[model samples]
Target: MIRLVLLLLLAAGPALADRPRDPGGSVALRVLEIAALEARGEEKRVAGDCLSACTMYLGLSTACFEPDAVLGFHGPRLAWGLPMTPATFEAVTRTMAAYYPPRIARRFLDDWRHTPRFARVEASRLIARGEARACD
Candidate 1:
């Protein structure tokens, strides 16, 4: 009986967790703050791409480009000449494209060559704060 009850509760847990979600409001703010603080400590500890991606997926555009946020999106490995797991590159890009309009998303995805230094800072910041763009 206990095992059955535990299974039932576990199944219900996901449903409860998914409903009335913030869409990353509180999470994004927290991440932004952390990133800023980290940048202060370390000269190059920023990850704006992660933050941007996370925000896009969450569908919280109210503060997408707010003054506090440093806009930066992650691009494919081909641009950086690094090995990116296909899954991650695809997942991140797809997430960005999913949330942002095609024009903006495309700009972010394909424009890594012009990725600003500040964007890296923002991405680092996003990663430090335990926030991520929702991929679902």
Candidate 2:
């Protein structure tokens, strides 16, 4: 019985891991999560409401998104709504931009990332604008 259960769990693991789920909003954890995904060397689909640190998946080499997926952006700050020092904010922005495609990195730095309010960009629109890739 123990062997059978272990075998079943092993068989189901990859399929389970590949299913997209909402990421709990955490900047450091998101970076670690993306690193793990990249290590797996399989394509990752970004789905559901991707906001906050979830937006960091844009930096992944193997990630794609559905047409209706919500990808939002804002300047990185404390999760508890505390103000970050100007230098810290700039550093965070640069880190996030490193993951984004070049044109997006430019626009995000120049315009939308200055506020806490989410600037939601639909995946379909991003695809249309050549800013993001669509899922197969």
TM-score per candidate, in order? 0.33, 0.75
The whole-model lDDT of each prediction reads 0.44, 0.79
Off by over 4 Å in 2: 1-24
Off by over 4 Å in 1: 1-58, 61-65, 76-83, 113-136
Candidate 1 TM-score over all chains jointly: 0.33
Clashing pairs in 2: none
- lDDT tens per residue, model 1, 22-133: 2222333544654664555523222223344344532343332222234444443344466768787666556556655554556566674245432333323332443433
For all predictions, the C-alpha RMSD in Å is 15.4, 10.3
Per-candidate count of clashing residue pairs (backbone under 3 Å): 11, 0
User: What is the lDDT for 60 in model 2?
Assistant: 83
- CA displacement after TM-score superposition, residue 90 of candidate 2 (Å): 1.1
lDDT of 1 at 123: 27
